[model samples]
Target: MDALKEGWFSEINDLWPGIAVSLEVTKVLHREKSQFQDILVIDTKAHGKALVLDGIIQCTEHDEFSYQEMISFLPLCSHPNPKNVLIVGGGDGGVAREVVKHPDVEKVIQVEIDPAVMEVARTHLPFMAASLDDPKLTVNIGDGFEFMKKHRGEFDVIITDSSDPVGPAECLFQESYFALMKAALKPNGIICSQAGTAWANLDHVTKTLNHCRTVYPVTAYGIAAVPTYPTGQIGFVLGSLDPTTNFREPIKIFTEEELDKMKMKYYNDKIHRGAFTLPRFVEKALTSSHEIPQESRKEL
Candidate 1:
């Protein structure tokens, strides 16, 4: 089995049974049990340095840009004027790096439950942690839930860069957390979260969408290809406070020159629109406002 292979480190995702992704570990760079979860850093044979939290790969040096750019830019671009942004649980600093790239963004406040995640990223994964030092960004080491509670209706865009829904991150995927996100946003504010792997966790996607519908009238789903994540694809759930907001269309489309300046890798206006066009099975499972009959369900 891959788990027992020599010089290999593997993460077995319980949600996805009978599969484990392994990497050729050159060395164990760092390991610690933080206040919240187990944080690990390793030098890999293929993906360069990797950040693992609670034995799950969160991001790798090679493909980190895909996740950081998509999650940060999707909601920011969809909002009319996202001058203020809030990031919950992205202690690694990749999301903060992308958020500060927008010239229109005046401020970004990140709340991380565990400071060790950021410290490990800084010491080992410096590339991903570089933006933690941006002047416009503030790193708050506290519970995101309490932070949002105190600062209500203050943010234009909120991004939840949480880990999967288990252990320390389990509460982040619950309905109460969605309600907290709604309260933290302005009237026209937009929010996006790393939902899960739709192909493997369709039930999780459906539950998140149902909770979002109860709060935000405008809710949409998007997916990105991240090989390190389970099923080689991950999904996002977006919700907008504005009733008429079209999550498919980004209000602020960056020029190619601007994208180059921002050092963006995977997020573009066209990709933003295309991400919402889900597979038939996924669409049927997460169709927010409609119910398909049994006969039609099989056809799809």
Candidate 2:
């Protein structure tokens, strides 16, 4: 993939075409060809430790909380009770760590396809992986799709912490995956998935949101800023079985004391509402006729 060159790691993929986000690497901590994909752990000069999968930067110690916290709390706080939550793909344990912090979340079940990612994270990224062994979490090594099929209408919330739509994670963005999640959720259940950056992949985001709208009574898209990600932004596709679901408003607003106790770094009641406020171009693209002209697909 030519990712590491001249002491720098650049994320170059056909998914985002010409643009690449590079980080200055101080040392290569670990690298391996796992059964599923290539995994690399590096200690960067500034961003601290970073987990890379298939030439893509999954998370860095510097800005991972923004993505992990927003993705987990956005759906968790929106639900009246997110007691039994299911995480589809978060091998680094960041999402699980954030989900268990919610007072309403009693139990969490995480399904990770690659065991090597978990092993690497546990060894190299202790800060994020520390909660993997929490009593409230059950770690299962298997495919999320097959797991959800057997346990139908079981969870109150399902958060998918998948990578970009490529390689092993390609199916996670498909319409069939949304259908299965809908079947796996209980009445009034909410589901959220990584929907990529609207600045670079608006068409991809729109397509996923459209797929979600087919099975969900209420659907909305939200964004978070992660500097390492393409275009310095990432978005989520959220949907709920309840018709009254409002993605813009949090059903459970945490007090300042609660936020301090939970160690929330990026999520709050106000941030939850602001995440849904899309830029003018993105708003038009998602709400307009489900067609993005090829000429308009340029990166903003």
Candidate 3:
């Protein structure tokens, strides 16, 4: 963990104006305005190399595994057989890195709009970008929505490793994106996406879950703790094509030897179940018998 002698990179979340997280910056590896947003790769004091997009911290070497492993494995393990997977907006390659670890997965198609993000990640974040060259992975540089529209009932599992609901990623959190993902999933397939934070954006979690229910009969929510993210936690929305799919339990169990072989750092069968246990307020908001009042509904 190398610390910078003088400079620092501060991530200020406009949505949550009260708090800001900063890392001691050692050196800037890359900085550029790509086709979408501002991309930056920096070496930090304690978290090692980190990726920042639009002045927000996306992932760091220290705790990125928690987010990558949880998001990728949660939906894949919940399905009976996840062979062909589609990842939307994981340009850094962390999600792809985790998706290829499942032995049952035969192919992975990653769609990212920005090629610059992948190029920077490959050079600065090798731990996550290492799997971009795997034979099982097929990288496509294009809009994820347009790509999914052409492929229907094709993917067994679809994971959206997108940034928060802002800038280029704003559309990714809308109902239309989930609708497209629903149409692209196999009959018994499952889809998962990074759905903001429960503590900071409960409205985001509630509305996203509500939108998902419109497309997929089986919909649930999960959370993971990451130090670099806002509120030190992130939430995921999961939807299943089959109404009876229980997301809390793993359909395909992994043995200890298999888990060790995968070298999973943060995700396991027990952790999968525990991730869905939301706080009282979040549970009430997401599963309320009555509609959320007009005053209670704040725009996400």
Candidate 4:
């Protein structure tokens, strides 16, 4: 039974083998949690219900906000100033917390497809999840693709914290989805999306980066370390209308000088720039235009 558990966990998720809020066989709800694309929502510790897809946690209702914050803030901080922001995916209300951190941000809209995930998060991860209740935030639980269609050229920043590109989050990685997101941003707006890991999913990251360049003037890739994410390494795809105009200078939000106080453990000037550094293998894969093989990947 232990070995089978290891195999199930190893095959489907990037999280550490044992790091979780809680783990109990959920027999209640009289549901097996299999109808939701093999994704099971298990009640966990402070973070809330964890979405375990195919026996692996695709996302959790709790502690996901931390991942969202570092993802959103670094890019959000990169932009000299960001006002309106749009979040695609992230039904857990994590991204919304980080966006409101900056005082300059006046409006934020988060579009999520699953209502159940959002409800679990709201009831569980409260401190960071509190932003979901903010009047400044307009929470829409539905298709992100449709929402982008109506709000053209509106947002200053767009953050995509999507799940793996296999099931529900697949469309979030398509060329058309990016095109619509590009259209929904202001002229000088910036775009950033979780491109998975350079170590495990180089093909996915490279594909996203290349596709983004076709629509936006500038496309760059960066990475950060989140212990729970796949390979404990994750990358981001950033696109800007004009890369030159999208520069950052330390301001009231903690400029290069006051950044000492910020003391963000993960983000720094060097780390920010280094996240774009691709390994020889990835660089080769992107240049050669070959789909990275399944065997090369480290599973989930």
Candidate 5:
């Protein structure tokens, strides 16, 4: 891997107090050259900072609620009564924050490798940063994969919010990780992960989705439009223990009265269901179910 400093700081004119940031060109110089997928670490901010791989915006200044809320709540809301939740690779504590919102969630264990991310998020992004301090949350700074190995059949929901398939987070995009995650889930548990960009990373997204199908009986995919992400596109892969779970039905998840109480920024029954409505091209790509062998995926 190589590093090159870019004009990232200059791009963001409005710098905040105590905000420490770093941007470097990251490379994987093996058989396939994926130069755009560089690793970026922004720390020393009011909250803790983060490391983002590829061009995808793993976390941002504005609203992480939209991403974390949708990903965690999608399966959480569906669960009859979720007790414990395990978040893999979400060091920033965004997902943990939302998971605890459920009245029934007793404990939330978040395993993130980078401690810098937790610090930056807590210091800078207050809306989400404070999630790290939730009484029901426990922070674990280490490899999420290794944590999964130690705690198999532990959590009712496991949400993977790692960066795109590149740099340090590349391993999370593999089929083996999905299998490991399945083993880490309780019999009634479900898993949701940020796959990749639907536009720029169709192959990566499809590959993850296909792999999920091989592991979980119930698997489906969804998309979101996050401005900071590459081409303003984001996608998620969902897996469950049951073989036949459908996400399309029930446009209205809550009563009009309940909707008023929980008026969210980006997600609703309509938006949640619409997020799964993929484009024709994506539909076709998903039709041909096959893993993108590392050799062939690298060629493109």
Candidate 6:
């Protein structure tokens, strides 16, 4: 790919044009073109092992916990009893790792579109992939959208840990996808999906939240600091079937000792409440009556 040059791997994409994030590559562990996308695993100089998909940085070993933990717990903790959880995408297994750690979560079913991404993560990024072996998690290799269509009103919580809305993951960001997730959830179920960076893709983020609003009565957006991601930040779109659901306050509060036991690095009760608090600009953009251009809207 054109992203690698002079021992540095740069992430340059049309989604965030004119800007890129580069990491120094110490060694190339594995690189190949999978049926779904280009999968690359490399040993970085400082950030540790990283997984790259279709020339975009999926996660680096350094700060992946921030995104993984927030995405997993923000919704899991919001629900009173999230016993059964369904994970859509997240081929790297990071989301699975965190999802299985929840005390209330008993069973996890992960549906990933690309098995090649999971294989590369298992071979090169075991820190995140090792959790895929958890007995509580049943891994399925298939299309998440089709999988959700077959199962209805089953899962208590469904987390969509997808990449940017492009390539194989494009369908996961649509309003239809949110509707499907709504159909696949049990009563009082909550769903969270990866929303793009507001700093770089505010309009796209607003569009995603708007799509969720059409499906679920309660919808909110939250963010976490992921240095490797675009703009050093990433956001998540959360929706709950219950109107009383508060995305800002988690129902299950973890004690410090419990957090330590779970090895949580970035997520806690305080951080959970703060994640939904957006900057003034983002709040205005999401709440204001400003109409998005026709071209900016995603075709349903």
Question: CA RMSD for every model?
Answer: 3.7, 4.4, 4.2, 6.8, 9.1, 3.9
Q: Which regions in candidate 6 have their CA more than 4 angstroms from the true location? A: 1-5, 289-300
Off by over 4 Å in 2: 1-5, 290-300
Question: Which lDDT tens digits does candidate 1 get at residues 81-161?
Answer: 899999998999999999999888999999999999999988998888999999999999999999999999999999999
| Clashes in predicted model 3 | 0
* Model 5 misplacement above 4 A: 1-56, 250-252, 255-263, 290-300
The TM-scores, one per candidate, come to 0.94, 0.95, 0.94, 0.76, 0.76, 0.95
User: What tens-digit string does per-residue lDDT give for candidate 2 at 53-166?
Assistant: 999999999999999999999999899989899999999999999999998899999999999999999999999999999999999999999999999999999999998998
Q: Is candidate 1 or candidate 6 better by TM-score?
A: 6
Counted clashes in each candidate structure: 0, 0, 0, 2, 13, 0
Predict model 2's lDDT versus the native. Answer: 0.91
Tens-digit lDDT string for candidate 3 (44-106): 889999999998899999999999999999999988889999999999999999999999999
Give residue 105's error in model 3 in angstroms: 0.5
- Model 4, 206-246: lDDT tens digits are 78876776677656666666655557666777777755643
Candidate 4: what lDDT? Answer: 0.65
Residue pairs whose backbone atoms clash in candidate 3: none
Count backbone overlaps in model 6: 0
Better of 2 and 5 by TM-score: 2
CA lDDT, every model vs. true structure = 0.87, 0.91, 0.88, 0.65, 0.67, 0.90
Residue pair clashes in candidate 2? none
Error of 3 at 79 (Å): 0.4
Model 1 residue 167 CA deviation (Å) reads: 0.9
